[model samples]
Target: MNLTLKIWRQENARAKGRFETYKVENISPDCSFLEMLDILNEQLVDKLSHPVCFDNDCREGICGMCGLYINGRPHGPDDGVTTCQLHMRRFKDGDTIVIEPWRARPFPIIRDLVVDRTAFDKIIQEGGYVSVTTGGVPDGNAIPIPKKNADEAMDAAACIGCGACVAACKNASAMLFVSAKVSQLALLPQGKPEAARRVQAMVAKMDELGFGNCTNTYACEAECPKQIKRSNIARMNREFMCAKVCSEE
Candidate 1:
C-alpha cells in the first residue's frame, strides 16, 4: 500500500515547526505504524536529511512509550489500541496521514512527533505508589481483598499513562489519567494506608503542572487507549472530597 505522509517536523523544542509531506511507496499492509516510520527514516538517511522523531520503546505496546496523534484521533482509528499496536492495514492505500505529537500545555513538544512526558513522572512521584516494607516475597493472599474490588482495581490499573486523555481533552485535563492512577489503589485494601495522601498529592501536582480540570466532556474516556472509564474520575473526586472534608473535620 502507498501512503502520503504529512509528518510534523521540528529541529528542536524551541525551533519553529511545520508539516513536511513525503510519499511512502511499497508499504506493506502488515507493517506496524512505527515500521512505516522506520521506512521513512531509512529514506531520509539515504538522502542525508533529518528524520522524524517519535517515541517508541517497546514496540509491542506494553510500555505505552509510543504516544501519538495520528490523522486526528489520539491513537488512530482503532478502538482501545496504542500507537505501537496500530497497524497499517487499518489505513487504505493513497491515504494522507497527518501525524502530530501530544498537544498539551504540560507536554511541550520536544521535536517532531515527540513531546516531553516528564510531567506524568512528576505526578507519579508526588504519590502514585504504595510504600511497602522491603523483605522477602510476600504471599499472594496476604491482603485478602474481595474478588470484585481486585478485578476493578486491575481494570483501572491497566492504564498505561499515555497522556492521550489530556491531549484529547479541550481543556487539556489530566483528570482521567490521575483518576485511573488513584482508583487502581483506592479500591485495594493494601492501598488504604496511603490513599488520602495519594489522591490529594496527585491532583495537586496535576494542577501545579498547568493541566486543566475536567468538565464532564467525557472526551478523555473516549480517547484513552486503555478504555479506562470516566467513572474512575468520579471515584477520584469522591475520594478527594472525602479526604479533604475529613481532614478539615
Candidate 2:
C-alpha cells in the first residue's frame, strides 16, 4: 500500500516545529507502524536527509516507550494497543496519516514524534512506589489478600505510563495516570504502610508538573492502551481525602 505521512518535525525542545509530508510506497500490510516509520527513515537517509526521530525500545507493547498521535488518536485508531503494536493494515492504501507527539505542557516535543516523558519519571520519583525492603520472595500463601482487592490492584498495575491518558484529555490531565499509580499500591497490603503518603505525594507532584485536572470527561480511560479505568481516579480521591483527614487528627 502507498501512504502519505504528515509527521511533526522539531529540532529540539525549544525549536519551532511543523508538519512535513512524505510518501511511502509498497508497504506491507503486516508491517508494524514503527516499521513503516523505519522504512520512511531509510528512504530519508538514502537522500542524505535527517531521519524521523520516534521513540521505541521494545517493539512489543510492554514498554510504554513508544507513543504517537496518529490521525488525531493516541496510538492510532486501535483499541487497547500501543503505537509499536499498531499495524499498517489498520490504514487504507493511499491514506494520509498524520503523526505527532503527545501534546501536553509536561510532555514538550523533543523532536519528530518524540516527547520528553521524563515528567512521568519525575512523578514516579515523587512516590509511585513502596520502598519497603522485602529481602526475598515471600511465600505466596503467607498473606491472604482479598480476591477483589488483588484483582483491582492487578488491573491498576497494568498502566504503562505511556502518557496517552494525558494526550487524550481535553485538559491534558494526568489524573488517570496518577490514579492508576495510586490505586495499584493502595489496594495491596505491601503498599498499605505508604498508601496515604504515596497518594498525597503523587497527586501533589502531578499538579506541580503542570498537568491539568480531571473533569470526568473519561477521555483518558478511553485512549489508555492498557484500558486503565477512570474508577481509579475515584479511588485516588477517596485515598487523598482520608489521608488529609487522618493527618488532621
Candidate 3:
C-alpha cells in the first residue's frame, strides 16, 4: 500500500522539532508499524539523508520501547496493542499518518519520535520491587494465594511502562502506570511486607518527577496498550491512604 507520513523530526533534546512529510509505497499489510518506519529510514539513507530516530526493542510488543503518537492516539488507533504490534493494514492507501513521540514534560524529547523515558526507570527505582527473599522457589501450594488476588496482581503486572498513560492524559498524569506497579505488589502476600513503604515511596517519587495527579478521566485506561485498568488507581489510592495513616501513628 502507498501512504504519506508526517513524522516529527528533532536533531537532539534541545533542538527545535517539526513534522516532515514523506511517502512510503508498496508496504506489506503485514509489516509492523516499526517495520514501515524502517522502510522509510532506508529510503532516506539511500538519498544520504538522516533517518528518523525512534525507540524500539523486541518488536514483539513485550517491550514498551516503541512509543509513538499516531494520528493523535498513543500506539495508533488500536486497542490493547503497542506501536510495534501495529500493522500497516490499519491505514488505507493514500492515508496521511501523523506520528509523534509521547508528549509529556516528564518525558523530554531526545530526538525525532524519541523521548527520554528514564523518568519511568527513576520511578521504578524509587520502590517498585519486592525485596523479601523467598529462599529458593517455593512449591506452588506452599504459599497459598487467593485466586482472585493472584489474578488481579498478574493483571496489574501487565503494565509495560510505555508512557502511553501519561501521553493520553491532558494533565500528563502517571497515576495509571504508578498504580499498576503499586497494585501488582500490594495484592500479593510476597509483597505484603514492603507494601506500605513501597506505595509511599513510589507515590512520592512520582510527584517528585513532575507527573500529574489522577482526576478519574480514565484516558489512561483507554489508551494503555496493556488495557491496565483504572481500578489499579483506586487500589493505589487505598494503599497510599492506609500507608499514610499507619505512618502517622
Best candidate, TM-score: 2
Model 2 TM-score (2 dp): 0.98
lDDT by residue (152-234, candidate 2, tens digit) is: 99999999999999999999999999899899999988898888888888888999999998899998988999999889999
Ranking of predictions according to lDDT: 2, 3, 1
| Model 3 local distance difference test score | 0.92
Superposition TM-score, candidate 3 onto the true structure: 0.97
Q: What is the C-alpha lDDT profile of model 1 across 1-249, one tens digit per residue?
A: 999999988888899989899999999999999999999999999999998899999888678889888988898888888988999999999999999888988999888999999999999998899888748877889868899999889999999988999988999999999999899999987788888888999999999999998999998888888899999999999999988987532
Question: Best lDDT goes to which candidate?
Answer: 2
Q: lDDT of model 3 at residue 11? A: 94
Q: Indicate whether candidate 2 or candidate 3 has the larger lDDT.
A: 2
Superposed Cα deviation of residue 93, candidate 1 (Å): 1.0
> Candidate 1 — what's its lDDT?
0.91
Q: Global lDDT for candidate 2?
A: 0.93
